[model samples]
Target chain A: MDMQPIVRVRKLNAWFGAAHAVKNVSLEVEPHSVTAIIGPSGCGKSTFIRCLNRLHEEVPDARAHGEVFLGDTNIYGEGIDPVVIRRKIGMVFQKPNPFPAASVFDNVAAGLKLAGIRKKALLMERVERSLRHAALWDEVKAKLGSPGMSLSGGQLQRLCIARALAVEPSVLLMDEPTSALDPIATKKIEELIVNLRKEVTIIIVTHNMQQAARISDRTAFLLLGELIEFGATSEIFTVPKEKQTEAYITGKFG
Target chain B: MITFSEIAAQGYTKRKFKNRLMCLLFFVAALVALTPLFSIMGYVFIKGVGSINWSFLTQLPAPVGESGGGMANALVGTCVLIVLASIIGMTSGLATGIYLSEYGRGKLATIIRFSADMLSSVPSIVIGLFVYILIVRPMQSFSALAGGVALGVIMIPTIARSAEELLKLVPASVREAGLALGLPRWKVTIWIVLKGSLSGIITGVMLAIARVAGETAPLLFTALGNRFWSWNLTQPIGSLPVQIFTYSISPFEEWHRQAWAGALVLVLLVFSINLGARFVFRPQISRD
Candidate 1:
């Protein structure tokens, strides 16, 4: 509690037309730590994470009102570009989406290359480091020249993680990164998340209770677009203060 | 329990007969659809092959009563007109399509899309007349530049519509992934989404090129069919389709033979273009 939090969200509200998706969510995430958001489907877990990087508003009818502070700067302040904010706070989606037209190596270098970084030496160095950090360097090092979409399903998800990490963001948001993976792939990604916490702060959204318990230092339970409970992962799993949190964690209801 | 014999008695034979009859109908319909394609190709080859000699391809057209000549001037003119049209058509068409699919979501887009659809259905002859009034009258002369602009107008609507459809096929997640990487929306639309659908767009362009290559009506008013060898864009130019049209209508027997040869060459040019497009822009190795 003594160390200053890296990310602080206050009075966050999101809507898709008239449907309010994320309602007044407030939380603080410690630097270089993992925070998991567990909830049932349509409970705003994904929307809450998206709002941190202003990605929630990308949808056609979507809008948000909130203050999200990233290292003392409110990202929603006037004249602040969402493009710049996104570079500082990276995101990984539920499905593994690697650029279909680019090679594995190029996919990892897309963010920098598109931002006008053209030196081959710089791109190669950053791509290698990101791949290593995502723990996919050994599996894909030989096939770096092949199309990114040619990778196996599990490997593609890790490749996506590497793509996100290549930009060197301070905070990483993962929206159901393991939902589309098989059991073994899911386990590997969970391990990767634990390892990644040492380099960057992480906020992960998952419906899997066991995953939140196994990898998170802190947990937030969201239900019907509201924050139901927030606490240390061990206590929330063992002795949740709220009855709804207990019912959800114990599998009585989603 | 009902036995297998009980099931068979329940109109099984009648249902099987109906299925066979429908399959036969579909097969016959397919054959009917293919008849015109094969017949035209076969007829063109049979009548046109004897007229095709090396000299017929290299030498300029001889005077009307003469026997020895070629369509070399027409070939080069066709090439010039195509190059001009491609520049104009591809640039504007691709831009319009990108705008329509990516940023066009209001009344203006609807009006543009509707206008494009109407323009595509307009007859090529009417397009020629419109260009005749717009350019030919103002310039007071038929020139390759005017002809090229006419063909280019015919190409725009086709390319724009196809580009829109092909770009729309790119999955939304792919675009979202680009945005999440901190790339601006325009960069994501152009470098990522547009680049991915490039092969499909090229295929569409090639088809439009082939269609315009065989067009005679638009060039009739603008190019006006030069008999002599010429390369100047401001002067009258000879094109394959126009040359074919002119020679086919003449009373001379020699010109008829040359007309058949020109038709064959034009058909072959279009066929090879289509074949080349497939070879050059084959889709990248994509799993999904």
Candidate 2:
């Protein structure tokens, strides 16, 4: 039997006021694999990813017309709460946006707390596990009481990941996770991403082609709000089917 | 070559003269603004320092010409009235500001903002008159409660406008971060937006208090004045501004001297509160 796809996007279109940001995007993400969307800036890579969890619903005059399925259930289906969908599909932003006011422990347990997990021992246990899963446990274990912002940039990004993972989502979405970090921190996060793929389906949007090639199993190239090509990471880099993909990988043009 | 050098020197002298003229204009403007500040301080010190006795601060106002009386009643009453006003003004103002910045958008927020601006510009005497008709007549007496409510009414628009401006200064990215976590909008505002802008909000509240504390017209008809100590909110209370106004207009030498002392005390109190607010709300050094 074929393994089930964790997320499937079909004919997705997103518009920001008068601007059509994403146009006719369709792709399927397999379970337990990293699918990195690669494109130049303003190519709707981020918008496409944001649609996976309906984060764009907050913007005024922002409307998305498409079908996004999360494990055979249409996420945008009627009566499906965006909050509940977000709880199941977590995201990490480009910047390490840990709640600046909250402590490290509270940051990791934020989702659980929102879900009304009030028991101290349960919160502590879940926070520890999530931190361990994000590979941030050893560094932040002793300083869990300290502010989340007190961590190094790379550590803070990982803490954000830990915070997202604490809700135990099936798919983890990362938007340029290590783009803000130094080389060493980027390498650490790349390794963590490789390890995380074993437990959850991972979708990442990144501008760094080399990082996408290194960490992703499949790569999707998007240009001007359209998905130009999708295939195995090696093939997309070495033998792209589309001219736009070749131009992008060889730095000929955005 | 000598003639060329002479021309260059003349050019330099003309430029220097123009620069000096500009500098002199700036200096005059600065000095003109500062003169009243210096004069007030000087006048207060010269007139009131001799009356700054322990008894003057500790004892109630005595008979019209007596030297033993202090502004004790006025001082305590002013503190109570300002505290009550601050509490009412700051809470309601903050809530309204949050509503405007977070939830309000089109016509309703615009109307509220316009009304608040108009309210801030309304004359303080008119505010006093309004309070006199609305609150004092119903209660059938001039009281500290009426005074505080009048001052709070004046302060509300100031505090709300400042708070709204401060809240707007908070970057949208901060709010986005909280919302991205699937937290509700209200939770994000209270737990994140409010915490991030706490210092700016406190500064706005302090500035509003300073503005209301020195107001003389609003309290003229509301609190009126008391000759002795009065704790009843329903009875007349002796705030420093009203006491200064009444005593300064009186012909007695002792009353005039006491007014000067009370004015000095009020100025000092306002100055210290402003300084304390600045110290408390100073930005923290970021580790990054």
Candidate 3:
């Protein structure tokens, strides 16, 4: 374990109304590493990841208990704006949802504009850079003024990633970013994630064990709102410490 | 195999009656809806075409039984009022809708939604009277501004409720995508949610304009009517519906003819606006 982990979760509990979505689970994410949260459906992996940035607050009855720290800063402390936390910790959702009304250029520039960057030349430069980082620049460079909805599903998802990267956040959260993509797009995004880890810390929630083993340095196994195991990706896949993790990896049960 | 003909005969008789009954019911329902539409068109054209002339449209309203007057000023007033009302109604309604759909979920939003629904159900005449008390009497006179404001009041609830419903139709994933990019709440609503629901909002605005344009009661106590051309917002103005209301009641043949012509123009105007909105806002259905 590193002396100063970038993100630390301690005794974290979450509930959606009366249903406990995330149990008292604790974990740490080292700085500048790709940590994959792997679990089957309804195992609270997504909920757990969402709690890091307080994204669950949008749900009417969603509530959380305990603490989350971003580099020693208590994320849930009083007077701390979730908006600021979210800006620091950007997220990409399960599906590709580019702003339908905006042009490709505008979609990439959205976060920058929100941060009050007004110079058009600077915005264009950053948008191009982010698009290139997301591996979408070549195909969309000529048609940056076109509506984002005109892009293919795979392209739109990458555009979303570019939009996320445009704001230059410290931590990037991806919730099944490639689940809706085809094999080729998924491979490209996986490659992008590997490249992105050099510059930004990443927390990815994926169901594909192969993907987690291929890209993540560390992996966390969650089941039914409880953290079953957390360790190096190779150990979690090959020699899990817990029987539940072993059984899950061996296709015994989700 | 043993008695195929007899089985066929039994099945055919049982199904034949039900099929005929269903066809008859469907035919009657279709007729019930189509008859009034066709008859109204027929009646309007038959009576209105006689008065549809350059003079009838360009001249001013004459005395009670006299003929040879135009509805040009009334038509212009109606256009200006409806356009202004639509602008006010759409902007305020869309803002209220975004607040309700995006930022609101608690008691205040619930109350606003409830009031909006209640207001939509209130009679146009009641809205007119309310505007009269609040606006007309306060100003101590009826004016086009008062009329447009009253029409805007009637329009706001309809547009706001429809826009809110449209905004609700947008999937939450779209909002999540914008938020995940660290976009602020207002930016997400304006850039994503509002854009996604733009077509639906336009439809609602157009429908609101159509509803208000045909209303005479609201304008009765507000704009009143002008005998000659008047462009001033602070003075009484002539409009199609109020003109139709006044002309339809007179016993003179010429006034009756002019009323029919005005009604035709009003219907045509509403129909064209609706058609234009549908043409502009309906999503493109590309083959690819």
Candidate 4:
């Protein structure tokens, strides 16, 4: 916990046309740790995480004004390439989207290959290491030539993780990565997230409070596009400082 | 009071009768729709099959009142024109489609989309005249290049519109996935989005080509039809549709028969192109 923060957000505000989505949110993520954002539906949890990688503005009429620092560099600084920032901070979506028509090996190696890396030996090595890190190499090693879409739901999500990890990003942002999964698959993903903490910083957005409490070291609560509470997971669950947080935790209302 | 079993029995009989009636009506409607298509093919086959012999295929057209002749020059000319048209159409059409689907939000894209729709509805004869004024008039003679340009113009709107729709069918998530890998926008579009939609684009291109293959009006003023074999783009050329038109208008009954044969050839060529596109560019739906 003595290392410099991997991601630092300062007074971020985002809007979708005339409607405000994320309002005046600020937080810092420690390196190689898991920070989970929890809230009800439409609380801008997804929007907040998307802003870290500068993907929120991709939507028409959607814009964000903020300063996000990756290590010592502000990602939104003048003349900084959003594409480069995205490579440094990878993302996993709620649905498992493996590039259609691509093989398992190609899916993992796509990032490296598109970046002009042509050496086959290097691509093979990176694809193997990334699949192994995502806990999918054993199940998929024999079927690397198969289409990525042919995998089971859990396996496809893991393949996406492997695809993201192949780029060797410093931070991984996951938006409700396990909501679409069954209990067993969800358990596997939770374990994988915990195991991945030693290699890269992780920020996950989730609606399931139990999932947040189980997999996260620290938790941030958002309500109606505003940050309500931010603290250690144990402290936030057992001793919330805000009344809204206490009500939400005690099953009073969303 | 009626029992439940009695009510169920009554409803079942009524439902069964209704279903059978609807099925019969649908069958009749389908037959009505297919009647014209089948009759045309059957009539053409009966009329043209007798004239399509080896001599008719390999030899040049005979002079008036002669017994037999083949449209060898027209057949080769049609193929050359199609190749030239495809090059022009696919390049411009796909580029326009990519622009419309990927980065088309502003006024320029709107204008381009509107122009494509408008161009698609303009009569082929009009387009022929336009190309004649643009190319043939300047060159001071009808040429195969002008005919190809006319056909290429006719192809662009259909290919562009269908390509845009096909590219749009690719989910936004796929594009986002490519972008998240740090690849530039153009690379993501060309390598990922366009590649995934390739089979559909090929289908669209085939449809456009089929539409222009038998167009005689455009080539009438542009290529002007040639009796002798010619491959030079600067000189007049012969095509199946133009040959058929010229032969059908002649006073000789022999020319009329040969015209029917040319029509048959043109239809077969278009049909085979469609089948070939489906066979070669079929989407890979099977898993390894």
How do the residues A127-221 of candidate 2 rate in per-residue lDDT, one tens digit apiece?
99999989999999999998787899999899999988888889999999998999999999999999998878999999999999999999999
Question: Which window of ten consecutive residues has the lowest lDDT sum in model 3 chain B?
Answer: B279-288
Alpha-carbon RMSD, candidate 3: 3.2
Backbone clash numbers for all candidates listed: 0, 0, 1, 0
| Candidate 1 lDDT score relative to the true structure | 0.92
Work out candidate 4's RMSD over C-alphas: 2.1
**Shift of residue A231 alpha carbon in model 3, Å:** 1.4
A best-first ranking of the candidates according to their DockQ comes to 1, 4, 3, 2
- What interface RMSD does candidate 4 have? 1.9
Error of 4 at B104 (Å): 0.9
Candidate 4 per-residue C-alpha lDDT over B184-209 given as tens digits, one digit per residue, 9 for 90 to 100:
88988988889778888999999889
Whichever of 2 and 3 has more DockQ, that candidate is 3
Per residue, candidate 4 scores C-alpha lDDT tens digits across A83-196 of 999999999999887877789999999889989998999999999999988999999999999988789999989999999999999999999999889999999999999999
Q: Runs in model 4 with CA error above 4 Å? A: B280-288
Share of native interface contacts recovered by each model: 0.63, 0.29, 0.49, 0.48
State the DockQ of every prediction: 0.70, 0.41, 0.46, 0.54
Q: B96-200, model 3: which lDDT tens digit per residue?
A: 888888888789999999999999899989989998998899899998888988899889998888888888877787787677666678878887789767877
**What is candidate 1's lDDT per residue for B1-288, written digit by digit as tens?**
999898887778889899999999999999999999889888888888999999888889998667798988998899999988898889988988998998898899999999999999999989988988998999899999889989999999999999999898888888988999999999999888998888889998998899899999999999888887887888889999999999999998888888998999999999998897787676766555
lDDT of 1 at B271: 95
Q: Please give, for residues A1-254, the per-residue lDDT of candidate 3 as tens digits.
A: 55589999999999999999999999999988999999889999999999988888777899998799998789988888887888889888898877656789988998888678999999999999999989999999999999887888889889998998898888999999999989999999999999998778999999999999999999999999999999999899998999999999898986
* Chain B TM-score (each prediction, in order): 0.93, 0.92, 0.91, 0.95
